[model samples]
Target: MYLLGLGLVLLLMKYLEVDPVATWSWWVVLAPFAAAAAWWAWADATGYTKRRAMEKMELKKKQRIDKQRESLGLKPGKRR
Candidate 1:
């Protein structure tokens, strides 16, 4: 994510003709994009992406359930 943001910022700076970035070679300025791509590829291959998505979904489900229980005046259950 950081690499992706950096890549985008560098791209914008170059396009805007900002000094330092504008003077940098295209390869240097765009390296972060390649890095970001490689990092994402590695995360996907290792199931890190799936794990994170599942965790997020689980959290959302828990939140929804809690809201329902609260509306129904039910006691809280065990925390994970």
Candidate 2:
């Protein structure tokens, strides 16, 4: 995320012909995008994305079930 934002800033700086970025090669302006691609590829290969999604889904489901239990005047219990 930081890389992408930095890349956008660099792109804007280069486009507006700012001093340091203006002299930088296209590769410099584009490196963040490449890094992001590589990062995403690595995440997919390691199942990081799916694991995060599943964890989020589990959290949401737990919250929902807890709410239901609360509405029924029951206490939520811890689950391992």
Candidate 3:
């Protein structure tokens, strides 16, 4: 995946006739790296393991709904 991205970037630079390293104005080259870093940081901070975050979120949502149902005096097992 890393090699693919690097190859695509190099292809794009070559096709665009842009000197990625020489052109100081090439902030585009940094965009993908910056985005990946930010995404990783956010996932790390949120305790979001890729395999478990979705399941955890779903569990929290169900618990919230159950709490709300109890507050409304609805039977817990009664599915709407």
Task: Estimate the Cα RMSD of every predicted model relative to the unseen true structure.
Answer: 2.4, 2.0, 8.2
* Cα lDDT, all candidates: 0.94, 0.91, 0.69
Residues 1-80 of candidate 2 have per-residue lDDT tens digits of 78788889999999999999999999989999889888889999999999999999999999999999889888886556
TM-score of 2: 0.86
Write one digit per residue (lDDT tens) for candidate 1, span 1-80.
Answer: 99999999999999999998999999999999999999999999999999999999999999899888888898656455
TM-score of each: 0.83, 0.86, 0.38
RMSD of 2: 2.0
Model 3 Cα lDDT, one tens digit per residue, 1-80? 36447646855775687765436344555566666677778878877766587898888998998899899999765865
Ordered list by TM-score, greatest first: 2, 1, 3
Which 10-residue window in model 3 sums to the lowest lDDT?
20-29
Once fitted onto the true fold, the runs of candidate 3 whose alpha carbons sit more than 4 angstroms away are 1-24, 50-80
Candidate achieving higher TM-score, 2 or 3:
2
